[model samples]
Target chain A: MSRPLVLVVDDDILLVAMARSHLSAAGYSVADAQLGAEALDRLDERTPDAILLDIDLPDACGIDLLQRFKRRPELESVPVLMLTGKDDRESIVRAFEAGAIDYIRKPYIHYEMLARVGSQLRIGALMHELSERNGAMTRELDVAARVQRSFLPRVAEVAGATVAQRYRPTTALGGDMCGHFIAADGRLALFVLDIAGHGSGAAIVAVAASGVLQRAINERGLDAATLRGELSAFVDIERTGFYATLVVCMLDTRSGELQLLNWGHPPPLLLERGRTRWLSASGSPLGVGIGPACELQTLALGEGDRLLLYSDGVCDVARDGFELRAQALELALRDEPTPAAVAEAALAAAASETIEDDDMSLLVLQREAV
Target chain B: MATQVIGIEQGRLDTSSGDTLERRVADALAAGASEVAVSCGTLALVDSSGLGSLVRSLKRCRAQGVSFKLLDVTKPLLRLLEMTRLASAFEMEHSSRSGAKTSV
Candidate 1:
């Protein structure tokens, strides 16, 4: 591999020659400029990894040159070391203020110069590595967000129900998810869950939670208790130190009987004939303090009944005082007896400026007369 | 609201009633300065815990004899204070000298 290039800028011919010799010996390619103006011209031709600059230049002061270099888009990230005659505190401070990475006094030792150069080079290499890592992570997050979004159940009309859903991630990818599957028996099984944390790890857990829920639904055949137990077991076995709050509901389309299981999740709001109440179940959040068996909450859904399942992110959206999220469900259902309208209204209520505290997901299900 | 300043550049320490920021404020107060001017400039990032720390420091400064004033409150820091309701507690000004003049 070719040696890293180091630019040497000074008005003194002897000093420039000495620096070139020392830097070349230390496995660095050396380029010399006698004045600040010449250095600027050379920078226009080829950018170097580092610059050894003299404070007093023939055409312009090194501090002024440093500022100019900082303003240039190309040279902004290149590290510069200032060489000064006096080691005064003010000058040293000024050098730093003007964007000098380090400073060396007049009549510098060869070892000290090489060491400082090596240190700055290491910093530059690390910075490049970090930038590349950040780029890769950004791309990965974009893909993850897309995949998480694809996993969500799109807005559609159920055979015997009206459905509405909304999902918003706090970060590029979030740990909140909601989905529904029409069982072979014509029962609609839907769930909303929030993993304990945010970011990529949390997203991973969210996906895992989804996988666990799917497997349980496939194996246990819509038994809410058995599915909850399986989900809790899966979380325990993973040992991710991450927990999830979930509310799963299986609505028997033929009978309109809703079997609900709430696992440390925000209670689902039930609205029927202008009356609102919470669907409560007895279970701890998955992988939390205790792993007790979840008790299913049974509710008989009348014609035009609406059930809203949400993550805590929706309820926790408050500015001055707590906004009663339960009330949001009532309002959403009151206007229209449809699930789509209810979900849209709830999202509108929780919408705010940038920086949402947590991810939000909602699943609204309405029972229609079959 | 409590405010404490440290270093020549007047680095700021703003806190409300809390235990987290008390130690940092006490250290600043014991440094033997009669009045400290705190500047919120250069405080690039703050988390929820860091906000708790600032509130604690303010309470400690008030317990001591030293006076606290906040200057150059950046937008991000101000937003944090607003979220926690600490912005209402302290007297904020553009500069340290102005902060002193406005104090009752």
Candidate 2:
């Protein structure tokens, strides 16, 4: 194992030199900093396992420096030994109160100083271990977040319709999911699901739902209602007790026919000719008993028509007893030609508010007027 | 803060409330309350964290054969639940009877 690194901070070169010799002989990697400023700079370069801080410095007091070190969460765990000449009970108490792990008096015995430093090094090793473990856990969540992103399609485009999406999870991994799929029959399938909760539990349910949707739409050629029923049954409320609100749709450009199925989700928007209309969900959300068969409503889409699908995280927040209504949602859709531009414009409107409590995802589909 | 009795006269139940609300719900389930009624009628707003806590609480209640209900949900609170598609997840004391869109 490599020797633990120790930083010795003192204005007196003689004392610094003495610490260097004692620390080096004790099998420690020593770095001497003659000024408080220099010591802080060394910390920035690499965190030492323990610090030997002088009580008196040209630029700052060692107690003040100790406060600064404690303020930094990353440096808080590192043991700091106060090097003082006063040896007074008042100063010693103050040093401990200021967060000094131990103290060494001026003109101290070499062996005594070595013992204090060694004790600190052992505690420092445990501190470093805890920090590393926390860091590893955070990295695992990051990796899982990226893996979740992979399950959703990046983009789906075809000759008649173009789909664009933007997804944001409240936590590193969230319950919100969205995807667009172009079927072999020239029908485009798009969906956005919001699980009741967030974090790993919600994320697991989202992944399973999205995975099934991808497979059913791509291979089975199922309709929106049938797909909804199957997915609802798949999530066992009696067992997992996890449910989701979702909007799933399939658009066929060949006959300008559109099929939509919604369960306790925000209504999708249809914008054309500077006008916007809401698409109806009108059914209880899934995992709530998969009640009466879902009704699939058919609508027509021609050139210049744009459809918007989103999760409720966009309008769940109420202002003055009113949340984003159809009129407000209509304004968000405005009129953008391409799916990318439309989603961009709409998301900008949603981002205007500061407080958001839910994860958000948006998917826009536009039929090429040309 | 005590967790056994979670009765808020009027306030916002949010992350700032910490795990207090969650603990109360857990205690209710542990005590075998046939149905735990969370009174949101006095609550002005609840953020996503609050909603998430409720979801977890409901799951716990279900595992123990208990019902989780939102008591006297206000118009704004009901709208929020509906928008999130959670209107059907938890039972509501006052339903379409009060012209409030909620699960019976």
Candidate 3:
């Protein structure tokens, strides 16, 4: 491999010659420029591994050139060692602010200068490696986000109910997910789940959880208790140390029966006849310490009744007088008519004064009495 | 909403009613303010203790009849708040001179 190139830019010809001699002796290729303008011209012709710059150049100040170098994509990664006459703290700080990698006072000792240059070169190499890895990770996350989006159910009307849903990922890939499946016997199975963490790892666990839930639903046909047990088993087998809160419910249109299996998820809000009540089931969240069989809760749906299923991000609103999950749901459903309106209002009530750490997902289902 | 602006300079609040900054903020709330807006534009850097001070200020504001807001937060300070989720707790403005935006 060729020795690393070091470009020396200084108006002092003697100092430039001395630097070139020492650097060349120390296994480096040295290039020379008499002024800042000449250095810029040389930079256009060929890039150097590092720059040895003098603060008092004739054409321009070293700080200005450092700023210009930082703006150039190709040169930004090149380390710069600033040379000045004084060893004042202000000048050293100013050099750093201008993006210089290191600073040396004039009349420099050969060994110290060489050591500093070597250290900066090592930092530059490590930074380059890190940048390449970051680029690859970003591309992977983009693909993951696209796949997560596809997993969500599209906007559609259910035969016996109106459905409205919303999902917002906290990161490029999120742990929150919502899915709906309609059985041939006219039972609508809908669920909203929040995985423990955020980002790509959590997203992978969420996708896996969804797959497990879908397979169970496809085979068993919305049998609420069976589905819950299968999901719990899947979580136990995976052993990913990741937990999820889920609210799985099947709505039977013919009988107006709503059977729910809640696994440590926020309780659903049941709105009927201008009154609201919490619909909760006693089951542990999946992936916690394994326990007894998961139990299912059943409730009879009344005419013009709406059921709201959401992640904890909605129920955990921090505003005053909104601490209880029931209170937040009440504020959202107080003046909403349709299922869509209720979903929108709930999201608005959950909106914090700033960005939320976790993703928010909502599913609203309203039964139309025959 | 009522607005009350509190300014901090040299990393210290002018009100010295208590030893800790949080206690001073609580004292300020007790002195009759409904909506508290803290200005930290001049602050260079704040440690975790300073952040705790700010959180205490927010909690005090909430306990009182006042709402909590922040103004003139530098970028580094904003990053600290974001890391701790304190940014989500208060209404934050870019600068004291600029009007507070309705949303973040």
Candidate 4:
């Protein structure tokens, strides 16, 4: 790394020379400005690690100079030490109020100058490192957010079926995910899953769980019991208190038959002929020490039937500080022309209320009557 | 042997509160309590992480040969437990629907 640069502004040429000798000897690069204008020129040329401003300048007041330095966004965090001859309470307070971080009386010891300058340089280096880390973290989150977005089921043109999906993460990374794949048996298998938290940690778990679930689906086929057992093994290696609730549904387009495996998620809604039915059959969430095998719930869809699956975050929407009931959610899904419109209506209702605190995901599968 | 009771407040038992529950259970067990029961009268939400915390606490209790129970579970929480098949995992006391106020 390059050496820290210290800019010293003073009318006293002798004092400037003394400071430069001591600071340079102590491994800091020093710049001297005899006038306030010269200091501004130096700042414009390149940013320094710290500034030492003499309170009485040839062309400008040091307090005013400090304020000017602070006004520039790039120099706002740079430490400025005020050098003053007067030790009066008013001038010291004025220096501080004007944004000088520290005040040193004139004729100070050279060792004190070196010590304070060294300390401020150290602090500046640490702050720069912290800022860099924060930037890196933000970039990583953006990539993770993109990866999470890719996990969502894309609009597939399945014969005799219409599919729509919506996702909103409460943070840069969300704990919710939805995915689908065509099974070997020619059934369309889709799942909506929610991890236990909202953020990067939960997002990582959600992605990992998605991979594990996909592998399980490929190996276990459409057997809910076998898939649950496979996930149980995956949970053993996860963090002690990390788990995910999932709902997986397989639709046979040829027969209009739907098979659902609800693993501790909110019950899915089946809409038919202006009425709603809740498929409430559910088992323990994946990773809670395998209890009973999840019971597969089956439903035969007639023409123009709709199946809506969502994370609990969607149904937990509150209006005017009151949480809406599942029935209200079902009502939101009513009369929507297409799967996309159904998702939009529910999201609109959720947005009208207080903002949801969790990640929200919705998937709608409709059987084409025609 | 004394039975320790941990009352769950109105907030959720999600990722943020899971560690606290585990710590409370550890403290209770360290205090020589032979049994630990969580009272869920006002708990509004229990997610998968919350359930995992409970399962971890139950495992700890069993390793120490202590009994773990749930007391006064609300209807919504009961449904979650039942749906997750965790109702059969622990011994539950009188539930809120049962209208019985039994001590641990």
lDDT tens digits, residues A71-94, model 2?
Answer: 988788889998888555677788
Per-residue alpha-carbon lDDT of model 4 for A1-370, expressed as tens digits? 7988999999999999999999999898999899999999999988999999999887998888888999999898999998989665687789899888887788979999888878887888799899999999999889989988987655468777888888899898998988767766777888988877678877877887777777777667657767766665435524444666789988888899988888777778889877888786457777766456577888887778888888866765211232355656677667877888888987776666645677889888888753
Every candidate's DockQ is 0.02, 0.24, 0.02, 0.34
Q: lDDT per prediction? A: 0.70, 0.73, 0.71, 0.78
- Among these predictions, the greatest DockQ belongs to 4
> Candidates 2 and 3: which is better by lDDT?
2
Model 1, position A215, has a per-residue lDDT of 61
Standalone chain B TM-score for every prediction: 0.63, 0.76, 0.71, 0.84
Number of the top candidate by lDDT? 4
DockQ-based ranking = 4, 2, 1, 3
DockQ of 4: 0.34
- The residue ranges of model 1 lying beyond 4 angstroms of the native Cα positions read A87-91, A155-160, A171-173, A197-202, A218-221, A237-243, A252-257, A287-293, A300-305, A316-357, A366-370, B1-104
Off by over 4 Å in 2: A5-48, A57-80, A87-123, A154-156, A219-225, A232-234, A290-293, A317-328, A355-357, B1-36, B46-69, B84-104
Highest-TM-score candidate: 4
Better of 1 and 2 by lDDT: 2
- How many backbone collisions does model 2 have? 0
Extract clashing residue pairs from model 3: B34-B66
Q: List the lowest-lDDT window of 10 residues for candidate 4 chain B.
A: B95-104
